[model samples]
Target chain A: MLMRCIRAEMRKLRGAGIWWVFALLPVISAAYGTFNFMQNREILTNGWYSLFTQHTLFYALFFFSPMVGVYAAYLWRMEHMGGGMNMLMTMPVYPFCFFAAKGAAVLAVTLLTQGWVFALYMLCGRTLCGLTGWPPLQIALYMLRGLLGALPVVALQLLLSMVIRSFAVPVLIALVGGVVGMALVAQDAGIWWPYALVLLGMNANRAQDQLSGGLGVYVLVCLGFTALLCLLAQALLTRRDVRA
Target chain B: MRAAMLAERIKAARRHDLLLAALTGLLTALCAAVRPEEDWQRAVGYSALTVNLSLMNAVVMPLAMAALASRLWDMETRGSGCRLLFTLQSWESLFGAKALRGLVQNVVICLAEGAVFLLAGRMWGYTQALEIPRVLWLMLCTFVVNAMRFFALLALSVRSGTQVLPLAVGLACSLLSVFTAFMPERLTLLTPWAYDVPLSAMRMHYDRETRITAYEPLAFPAGLLAAAVVCGVLGYVLARRAVRDQEV
Candidate 1:
């Protein structure tokens, strides 16, 4: 049933033109990152590590969470329309399956975006920055970790979009959350903030590994937050009366 | 016109649009609060606060305008693409009402932001006196830029019948504006979102070695202010046309 719901989501997303948003944002980030990286070569002497920070810093800090908000909002938009939520509630599928299906859809898009960001990083590093060697293995691990970190954000945004009928508000909240996350990371308390998880996982704006020896705790936190958000969403769906 | 404006106000009240405006102001205050307190004690502390406030405005205002504009139009778009609303009122009145209401909300946000800066300076026990005129100038600059962004997003929301496009553009503009602080002045003038930093009454300089930062006053960029006004008028005209010619 979950697979069926997921398939239905995929069908709804067909030709939604949301890909342009995902495709365009990274390009802008890469352009700004590359330009900044080239202009400051003397100070940015850490080669690929410096380049990684340039590419991911603003993207991770401002763009990624809200992009997820857009995706989640778009997914739930149809349901919020006339009589759609009532129809969804009456369907045979459990509310958990319905909400999980949305999460799965957003997760797939996030995975694609992470890959695209990595591709841009490598492309900019080798071609634009004129770096000679392949990106370090740690960069790949960062990308994977970024994907892991994004799971909680995706779940949280889906929950917000589900509850908030207005599409733009959730996106605004996501942007604010990202800014707050940056502040938390700066204060050395990022590990406890759900919004800060992706920034910490990506190791944005820093040459050194931010998680380092605490990878276990980071993973546990990400998983724990993801589960908690998903359960909260399921509970909301099960308990609330259908407004539509 | 009065009735239309009243209707817009009623719609905004229902949607809790004032709350969003207040939230935008609070977010700016929060961003201002993140600066180190030591910097606030410098001789040019108020200047530093002004610079920081403008940069924070660049980050927060564009998206807030987008959200506000999109929410204003979302009701119409959701209910048969304004077909019903058009039957009752002229497009010009509808556009004027929304534009005025949104501009009023933008004014509220700007005033609240200026209040935040003053309150922060007082709270931080700044050495320098707060410049009332400069704060008002910054507020005016922010309002013009945000009004321009609001019109552009309003047109996009009206045309697309979806909030996604406007929100995406807002997010992208906000991201770009953050980096614009590092770009050259000429380059910064080209993007509307980047105007907050360039039009600010103060400029900041940081010494990498000593980690000391200083703020200095800038000559007012009257030409840039003129350009922003022109762009805002153009956006408003374009948005008006979009509403008038929108196919029901």
Candidate 2:
């Protein structure tokens, strides 16, 4: 039943304008990446890795975090409309199931964005920068790690979106969170800083130097944080009276 | 007119935009404070303040404007308020009131920011004294720039009936504006978001022979004024049309 609910939620998004965000975000990030890459070409001697690092930083800090926040807010928008929440509660489905399905859809979108971002990163490395040596293993690993890292952000956004009826508040917090995360990333507190996880995961400059234990710690932190957020969200959803 | 403005103030108070505006100001101040001392602790205090403030304005104000505009519009459109507002006053009057609210919010934010910048400068031990003319010039420029964005975004918000899109566009612009520091002044003038880029160039430059860091206001470019005027006119026209076309 839960699977059916999740699939239905995903199916409902077909032909919706929500997909434009996913399509446009990568292109926008790529354009910025290419711009920065070309601008720094004279100074950047580390080749593909340096360019990729800058690209991933821009993607993680600005584009990806806000996208998660907006995606979560968009998921709840339908229900938050006047009398919509009450109408939804009248349905036979449990609130937990409804929220779980929505959360799953958001996660799917996050992974989709991560996959496209990874593809664009590699493409930029190959064609634009003319780095022929394919770092396939590292690229795949970073992609998976980035996706895992983003899970906590996705869950937190979902939790916020579900709790706060105001659409902008969740997004505002997320944007502020992302901006703050950039500052936090330098401090090397990735275990506690979910916002910095995406940057830490896909950062070629830092990751290339310390890939083994560093990444494992990030993955563990991200997973633990994601689990805590998901559980908290579930508890909150179940306890909430449908008054929206 | 007084009644309309008063009512708008009450509505704005309820919406908590003033709080958001102040919060944004404090956040911008905090973000500016996070900068390494060397960046802002230049030989000439005026240059340092201008540079630091310009960077903060570029990064923070655009998003704040979008969010505040969207939130105000959303509050009006949430339920029957959208339909009811038109009945309470003429579309022009309603538009005026809302525009006034935005202006009030902007003024509050601007004042808060100015206070913080002064406090930050003093605390950071800026070597040069506080230069009023340059400080006032940047403040006025930022005010106009923010007002222009508010008008444009309010129009977009009213027409679209959603805050997220306009906010997203603003966020994207804010991201792009970070690179405006690198672009030529002429190109920066093309985008309203980079109104500060020219001023940001007025940093304490090192002289080769004298071995001194000279502090000066980069000549106020005529092109930025033109850009501000263009944005103002465009925003007004769009806003007029939006308010006129608003059904609910």
Candidate 3:
């Protein structure tokens, strides 16, 4: 049933033309990142590491989470409109399956975007930066870790989009969350904040692995937040009256 | 028109549009409060604060305007309220009411931000005298930029019948605005979203070795400001037409 729900969600998204959002934002970020890196070449001499930070700085800090918000909002948009919520509640599928399906769909898109961002990073590092030996193994690890870190954000945004009928409000919240997360990370409190996790995981604007000493805590926090959001969503789905 | 505007206000009140204003104020305060104390002691501290505040505005305003403009129209789009509402009122009156309400909200938000900047400066115990005129200038520039964005997004929402496009474009514009700070000045002027920083009354320079940051006053960019006004008027005209010609 959950598989069926996931497929339904994917089907709804087919030919929605949202892929351009996931594609265009990173290209813009990469363009800016590479330009900034080149302009400050003398100071940013860490080669691929410096280049990686440049690429992910704004992408992680500003663009990525909001893109996730857009996807989550789009997924729930149809459901929130004109008798759709009532129809959804009447369906035999468990609310958990309904919510999980949306999360999974958003997760799949996020995973693809993360890989694309990394691909752009590597391409820029090699062709633009011009000195790359297979790109460091740690960079791939950072990309993977960034993907892992995005789970809680995806969950939280999914939950928000579910509750907020306004397509833009949830996305605005994500942007503000990203800004607040940047502040929290600056105060060395990234692991505790779900929005900060992705920034920490990406090691944005820094050459060193930000979560090196606290990787376990980071992973645990991500899982904890995701689980909490899931429970909240389920309770809201099963207990609350449909707004429609 | 007055009746229509009053009705728009009542609708906005019920919709809790003021919350977005509060959010904007709170964000400005947060941005102000987060600066380190040491930075406030420098000779150019107040000017530096102004520059930073402009950058923060650049980041925050696009999304806020997008959300506000989208929300104002989304209610009508949902359940085909636009058709029902059009039956009762002229499209020009309806469009004017929304635009006027949005303009008023934008003013309130800018005033709140300027107030917060003043309050934060006082709390931080800065000795530099607060320049009321300069702050007002910054606020006015911010209002212009936000009005432009709000109208653009409002037009898009009305035409597209979907809030997603305006919001997505808003997110993209926010990202580009931040990056615009890094681009050449001539190029930055071309992107309306990037106007907050360029229109700022002060600019900051940091000396890497000495680690001293200085702020210099800049003549207000009248040409860009005029361009923004032109774009905003164009957006208003387009949005009005969209409402007038809307099939229902």
Candidate 4:
């Protein structure tokens, strides 16, 4: 039943004009990073992982999380409009199931977008910088880890969109999270901050830097925080009376 | 028209829009203050502080203008307000009032930023005395640049209907503005987003090898003012057309 609901939610998003919000950030990030890489070609070494890492640091630091917020907000936009929430609540389905299906669909889109960005980064690096080594396994590992680290951002943004009703607030929160995350990346405690997790995870995979001992703890924190937020959202949705 | 302008003023004040702008100015000031105490005495000079603030402003102020414009415009378009707003007043008057309010708010915020620079300079042991004319000129340039951006956003808001599109575009431009400092001079003149680049009150001459630095006034206030007038008229025309289409 939940699978059907999720499929139905996905169908609603077809031709919905929200895809650009998902695609723009990654494309811009990769293009800008590629431009910078080429401009500094003399200074930068042409290794595959090295080139890929330089481009993606800005992505992980700034674009990835906020783009997730945009996706979540786009998904919730319809339900927030024109008595739609009240109408949905009047139906016989469980509120948790209804929200879970939407959440599932958004999560899928988020992961797909991340994968596309990863592939695009590799393609750009190979073409522009004469990257040679396949490094397929390393690339996959970084994508998987960064996607894992982004789970909490997805949950937090979903919950914020679910509750806030205002379109810009959730997105601004996510953008501010990226700014705060960037600031925290300079301090020792950045590894513990949930907003900074994806950044730290990406940094751990860089070819130049030795993987810090705290990478394991960072992964655990991301998973734990995701679980907590998901549970909190579920509890809140079950209790609230839906109103226009 | 007077009633419409008054209504717009009340709505703006009620929404705490000015407060948000003031807070942004303060935040920009705080960002400028991130220097060591030793640098604070010597290196944290007027032109240097202005350059730092201008760089931060390039990243932030465009989006802030977009947000403010969208909030003002979107409030009238969300749900029942859309239908009611059109019926109550001519769209021209409404648009005019809102645009005026936005322009006034931006000018005030620009001045507030200038005031912040003066305070930051004096408080941080800036060696030079307050150079009010140069600081005011920078403020004027910022105001003109933001006016152009605000007008562009107003046009976008009228056409897009939804709040997200204008915002997303504005933010993308804001992100691009971060790199404008490094852009070549000819490119800077062509890219509307790079207007802030020319407004950098600090003229930096860095010796790539020797690494010596010097500061002078770097501003093209007249050029920015001319651009503002042109973009402002274009925005007005576009918004007027959008309203006409809505009426049809």
Candidate 5:
């Protein structure tokens, strides 16, 4: 059922509105990189990496994370919009299964979107800087660190989308939360700062020295918080929003 | 005219006050007061004030524009213009009225807060580049930027029934940052305000030789004004469609 729901979501995105967002992504990415290319053409490769490194969290905080959440919330909303919620609620499927399916669908879309971003970066690198080579091993490590960092953001967004009724509320909250997170990040006592989780996924290549010295408890702390957030999300869903 | 009806439609859709009040209160009370001083002796009283201003402007309120946008029409009663508003016509007029209303409301609240901060600073005998008026200027700058922002967003909501949360914010911050980043030496000779005041007065520059870049009011206001025009046009188009689109 979850897989089925994921397929449906893919099909639904085939609509004009959702595809416009997808189309807008590459254009925006290219535009932003072009802006960078114009300013610091010499550091194009490192610049792209740094741009992704710093901006990924910014994206998660303000845009992508909340987008995924809103996308999920709207899955429920689509039903309501179509006057199908009553039928869905009375269907043979468990209520939890319905949300679970939406969760899977959102995750699939997130990874697909991220994959597009990765491709966009590669393509932009080749076109803007006229380079045809892959970045160093540290680049992958940096991306991994970023993904790890974004884990909690993903979880929190999921929670917001799951419970919030208004289609716009969760994303709004996430945007507000993102700002608050960035301000308090430097003062963070530890990596448990969920907003700072995106920092966990940061490419430590710039500070290669830090990675070799050991992730210095930050990595574990991020993972710990990610786990904590996931548990909280699961519990929250079961209790109110996503029932079995 | 029918334009008044459409404006009322949009007005009913959104809830601007929630965003305004939350941002004002949050920035004043929570955002501005974070970890005030690393060490009191090292901290200039005004420097603390700058941190307060920076948080208040950049982090707290600017990003809420989308939420304000989302609410703009969501709060509308049946998504129609106020039957009573006699002054509106065309989608642009409706958008203008809403945008102007939002700007005035934000500015008024901000000014009221400025008075309190001004009195406090005078009591502390704090007189420097970071003055109450400068802070007020930053707030106004934020207000102008946000007015354009909220306007564009509400306009988008009118067109599409929903606004892209992240996209709206990225654009707003990048727009806002242009003003906040450089100060002192360079001429952002971009606007009257940037020219009238010290561009870097409210800015914090950590890594440059001059430390802060001078403000460029011209470029920012131009960008913001252009955004206002484009968004206003698009929002009006959306509202027109929404009015015509059969309810689902």
Candidate 6:
């Protein structure tokens, strides 16, 4: 039943528009990261994952996560509007599977997007700096770090989608947050806010002399919160009015 | 009856777009005011331009062309307000009117803010008299780029129900627009802003090695501004079709 539910979620996610949304991740990441990489090509040589983690991680948390969050919310909104929730509720499956399937799908789509972006980014790097030796593990770790931070944003979007019927609101809210949040967070570089994970990863990857051991504590806290958020999302999805 | 129908749309738009515009204008100016003139490049210039691109294009303008277009076509989810403008308006005229109004209002507000910014800059003495023309030209080009933004955003918004994705896409495109600055000065012969201002005329090369050329005109804002008409018109046409088909 759970597998079926997840499959059904994937079916809706296959919508052409959603694919375009997914496609946006790499294009945005690559385009902007390229600009940054060119602007300061020195720090980028640490490796694929390190450079991306450093340059793109900060963006993933604040702007990228929020933007992606809206699309995540929009994914469920399809079900909400199509009356899929009520239809699924009648099935033999536990309703928790519904939210889980949807959330997992969003995560998968995000990974696919970020993954493609990573590939394109590496290509850009090679073109510019004659770089080689694909460090899959490091890049994977960097992506994992970004996904860990993305949990709260995804959870928040899901929670908001349940209450806010309008598909328009999430993007606006995310924009407001990204614009304002970056301004505030740019001040304290070491804070454990979900947006800073990429910066931490990037800094850690860069392994520059400027960083210290305090970053490990920040990572532990972020991962801890990410787990808590997943639990919170599952609980909310189980209890909330799916029909609304 | 046709006149009445048009009147109703104008009213409906005023209700949705006008209040939002005024509020957004105040918010934009307030946000811009918080930073000192020295930080203007980061705060107002790059950030505002970016958010306007990668973020909410309509939120900044209030009566964004997309909202106007979407509302006109009824692809947007229904509003709580029960008005005949929702039912009676044709998509073509509706989008045309909305796009036109949005352009005018956005430009006016932009000019007002520009004036205030200049006034503030003068009072603070951040620039000299010689720099005023260059600044004015930059502002003029930015205004045109904003026009393109309105066009591009409106068209995309009508096709995509979620306005943010398109806005972000536009933002990404704006970033891509920077690549034009890298073109050799002689290659920039196509547009008025680029032609009149001259790519070399506006500090084409940034000596970032020294970090002193941060104020240099990294790209021809005029070329971007000139693209506004083409992008805007194309956006309008696309928006009109989308609205007609109820595409979003």
lDDT of 4 by residue, A88-206 (tens): 77777877787778778878988888877887887887787667767557667667777878888888888988987766656655655665666566655666667777877766324
State each model's CA lDDT, in order: 0.85, 0.73, 0.84, 0.72, 0.50, 0.51
Write the residue-wise lDDT of candidate 5 on A1-244 in tens digits.
Answer: 6667667656765552444454454455445444555565544445555545433434444445445545555565556443355566666665556655665666666666666766666666667656556755676666566666666666666666655545566665665555555555546432555755554455322333234455656677666876776677656545543223
Q: Could you give the DockQ of candidate 2? A: 0.36
Best by lDDT: 1
RMSD of each: 1.8, 3.6, 1.8, 3.5, 7.0, 6.7
Interface RMSD of each: 1.3, 2.2, 1.5, 2.4, 4.8, 4.9
| Model 1, C-alpha of A159: deviation from truth (Å) | 0.8
**Per-residue lDDT of A168-195 in model 3, one digit per residue for the tens?**
8888888878878877888887678888
Ranking by lDDT: 1, 3, 2, 4, 6, 5
A10-63: candidate 2 lDDT, tens digit per residue: 886777556766777677677677777887777666776666676676677655
Point out the higher-scoring one by DockQ: 1 or 6: 1
lDDT of 5 at B219: 22
Docking class of 4: acceptable
List fnat per candidate, in order.
0.45, 0.12, 0.55, 0.08, 0.14, 0.04
Candidate 1 chain B weakest ten by summed lDDT: B33-42
Tens-digit lDDT track of model 4 for B58-165 = 766666677777777866666647567788888778877888888777877786787777677666666666678877777877777788788888778777888778
Worst 10 residues of 3 chain B by lDDT: B34-43
Model 1 alpha-carbon miss at residue B44, Å: 3.6
Q: Write the per-residue lDDT of candidate 1 for residues B1-248, one digit (tens) a residue.
A: 99898888776665677777877776775666534456455567667767877887788778888888898898787868588888888888999999988988898888788777777766666777777888889889988988889998898888787888888888778878977878988888878767989999687888878987777898888888899999898888878888988765
Model 5 CAPRI quality: incorrect
* lDDT score at residue A147, model 1, on the 0-100 scale: 88
The CA-based lDDT of model 5 is what?
0.50
Segments in model 3 whose C-alpha atoms lie over 4 Å from true places = A242-244, B9-14, B32-34, B39-43
RMSD (CA, angstroms), candidate 6: 6.7
Per-residue lDDT for B177 in model 1? 90
| DockQ-based ranking | 3, 1, 2, 4, 5, 6
